[model samples]
Target: MQRDQGVPQPRLLHIEADYSPAVSKTEPWVDLRSIRIDEYLQARSLAVKTQKAYRQDLQHFLRWTDKAWSAVTARQIAQFKTHLVRKEEGQRVLSDATVKRILGTMKAFYGWLWRCGYVDRDPTIEVQLPKLAEPEADNLSDEQVEKILAAVAGTKLCDRNLALFAVLQHGIRAEAATLLNVGDFDGQRLWVRQDKGGSKGVVPLDEEGVQKIQAYLGWRMSQGEVLLPESPLFVSASRRNRGARIGYDTIDKLVCQLRDITGIDFHAHQFRHTYATNLVLDGMNPYHVMTLTRHKSVQSFRRYTKAADQQAAEAAFYETKRRKRKTEPGSEQ
Candidate 1:
């Protein structure tokens, strides 16, 4: 009786395999404590949310199959995907996109196992990922962006807000913003060390961006606060967490605060989308823009190009028909 190893199992749910689970209760032969999940997560340098999602998705699969990671087969992985897609009452199910994500995670899991010598073969190779619709790129307009900026101007954290948003509008993510340090900025390049989905890189800053940051730092120093190279770029000014590094929740609250003040509802991530969309609108090659956006995958990058394409086509058609007339939505009737 060989002990199942590789990914550590939590507890026995129901063995979906033809054979029964190993009779050994202690499972002394099994390397349960040595589960490579933490190691794999750290190696990937995944974002906190992504790490959580990967853990959850993997756990769900393990709970369903109730088999050792070594025993999972390509066929069984496919079966699990099928189980996710076919919605049944009182049963675990997922959307097509979600099913695709789960299978992709599984593929990564098994690929790691094979590379690390834990498995002779990758079980996820033959398991097909479910097709999902191309994700639509969402963005705010120039005017809406300006409105948000204005809304943040009157706030007590105006200097910080201006500098933070200046960076965000250039393609940095919210999570990456929190990870930024004073040393990461050198007046020209903003080095984002911790990007979402692990896409870390240096983002170039324009003259205005440099000024915004300089003003923020100047303001920090003006208030008798010492700015160090190791200091967090953004710190909370609230009574409870003053002088402390801001968290992801703080970013979310900032978005809500801006939306409420400006009466323009929007998401924090839209800053990156807006940056990408505007570049595509300016006739940048989709492939080239990824270098600026630091996108790791072309599939996700397609949304920017597609959205820009649609908008350009519509504008061109309307301009031709109206002879420089702007068409409003639902005015065709």
Candidate 2:
């Protein structure tokens, strides 16, 4: 309290200060602090998978730098690259692609800090990047795909497996697949949530895919599972995990089971590659494929396109050789 004009007066409370009125007992305001790497990540409107990957990569960089963000230098950045490439017990700790990815994470993180005025400069601006090989898009052959479908058809959870396979056939990422709720689909279209830097769009569903999903839903109802708008489209079939939506690891195990049964070694991502390759080989417009695949850039879409071209060229070359051999005398049919 203060005396003003010979009258007692209550002191003015500064709004920005930590003090609050005692009468109401309201919650305190958010405590503002200095910028942090985690704060940068939280501010970013990145996809869940991208945010997770970037966080893991930044954590590795932080472990190496062993100092505050502002204290890091370009020299330390180079050293971090060397550290990533260094061998541990006669094996390289990180692959070339992984090293590049780590550098990318650093570039993004430091760039953010610089923009936020927390750092004087981006140390990663001049850091040399590892020369990475062109990514190879591995996909399954038609015969192998047929084998997987056949095995799933013969499985005990036939309806569930069929639905999963239909989803995989569309090249949907496992995370996006798991995030799918019952209302994410209509009879003919699927509303996909965005993946890493991907666009969210309604993709057309094949009749077979829709049918399999409906069959699985019907089976779930028969098993006393509640079918609601917010319910998971795909649920765990195991007793321990029953009625809960399948996770990425569980989906991985499901694909592994297919591999074991059919002796075809492949992962969920390979199915995506297969689907993209099929689109390219079938002469779908590149832009259309990019839109359907939700790829943000043509560069990513081209990886599948390039792979398809190589496969087509090899097929044509073998056909030419076959014709030449048949034209020659005494060639077997």
Candidate 3:
């Protein structure tokens, strides 16, 4: 028998043959100690959460390779992708989406390395990511959305929750919502700050949303919190932290509370889905919907369109059945 090199032996969780290129782990590898990964991360100006995630992802690769960024080859990157997708010790590991994210980060890191002259060549150039399944578009019905709004409307801290729901309904990100200041709203339009492309844009609020926001502002004044242009639109009500900008955790907790009260397992993103679906259902062009949602790509907004199409198809089918039943001689009620 030919003495086996350190070829990855077949395991219980068979990796697809396509990604399993013939490679040896014992091949010459360099440690990543010298790579200026921190400098790279900071240079990108990533959001705090995103920076943390990228660090974690890069750490996973470093630990796996035990090699310097310069010593890493495309083969190893491909192998790493395989390792991430396969089951580790009888347990399924990362999902395809996670694997894709990891690879994307690595590609960016290595590309940066090459640009900065840290490496002669980028190793992650040709690594193919697993196809990501189209995200399922889950949106609550208009009635369900109204019920959620009503559940928090006019209740204690109603101002806060009302603003939260309205912002979510308008499809603003939770982080963006948390950063909103009193001056961002002008009775009719809400200026969404720190949007994805690092620019501010205005979204028109309906009269009802504006009225509720004004009511909430009035309530804040009643409690002696002065409403200044620079004041945070949403603030903590506790005496200790009064007038302090509300953090994302507080917004998330509020969403969870409403979810518990309504028995609806929905989050802020679902509100965005609901907004998009409602627009599609109301015969608004998806292009226009994407414009309102500030989606950079049509592909991002197409999920809502697909969901709306399915709902419309089901409604038409049921309506046809109902009409057929009514036409039958003995089916009339």
Candidate 4:
């Protein structure tokens, strides 16, 4: 598969199987005696994570039915959903979104099985997915962002913190930022590899960005350590002695700390929103912003470009008008 700059493509699995005998069955119900998940995933070209999730969901459904999938009816699927709502432990009932995901997985698996001739019928065909409630968009204000940055300033982990800030301010995704390594950065531009969907992209380093990074690199070099080309740019201090890259969990914790310090109840994704919102507020076109963010769809980008504060919007509007008025001959004092 062709990859764009800075975007990581989903892993592809080639499927090779012949199910002609199974597809020829005209029976309403076919036996699922030896349907292995690994074989199913291999046949469907599904990602490994997706394969695991679907198999787990299928296992739960099978355990509930206490019979082979060929013997399970649509009614049993409904019963399993009810069981998930009532008898499940941990946080009580599962959220509608979670339940819908499980249902989707089941539907896809059954549909594939039926299509492949492993099953004569898809029992989950009529199962309706639950309605999902849209979540309110969470974002940080400029003041909040400033506070978070200030809190990180003069800290022992200043370099890593600044790198994280650069990602947030520049609207880069956490995954993309995490994949950054020492060699990807030249003096002029930062080469982001396989960021989203295996797309490679380049981010030009502005003067400020360059200076900040240079300062960090100078400090790093003073320690007389040689960083490998494949080594992570932002490594964990705890594992510095061991020369290990920082994991996703550490990044998540740092985000939470920033949120607490700034008193902003937001996730790491909110930084992307904050960046996009600021750009739109500055009169940048949505399409151009999408290019910088590398969003595949406009609708997805729109969600992040939410309206800024009413006061800030009005203030900016008046400020632009004031500047325009000053440029006019009669309007100038």
Quantify all predictions' global Cα lDDT against the true fold: 0.85, 0.82, 0.82, 0.71
Error of 4 at 186 (Å): 4.0
TM-score of 2: 0.79
Q: Note each model's CA RMSD in angstroms.
A: 15.0, 9.1, 18.8, 19.1
Which portions of model 1 show Cα errors greater than 4 Å?
1-34, 88-93, 310-333
Instruction: Tell how far residue 5 is off in model 2, in angstroms.
Output: 48
Over 4 Å off, model 3: 1-35, 197-199, 309-333
* Model 2: ten consecutive residues of lowest lDDT: 29-38
Candidate 4 residue-wise lDDT at 146: 77
Could you give candidate 3's per-residue lDDT for residues 1-333 as a string of tens digits? 986788867769766668667886796664445347788977886667777888888887877867777888889998999889899788879888888888998999888889989899998999998897787678887788878888887457887788777888887778888889999999898898765545367778887788778888998888787789989988898788877998889878877888888988887778878888888878888888887788887777788899678878999999999999999998867
What tens digits encode model 2's per-residue C-alpha lDDT throughout 190-265? Answer: 8886465656876787899999998988888887877888888888878998788888888788788888899988
Candidate 3 local lDDT, residue 278: 80
- TM-score of model 4 relative to the true fold? 0.66
Q: Model 2 lDDT vs. the true structure?
A: 0.82
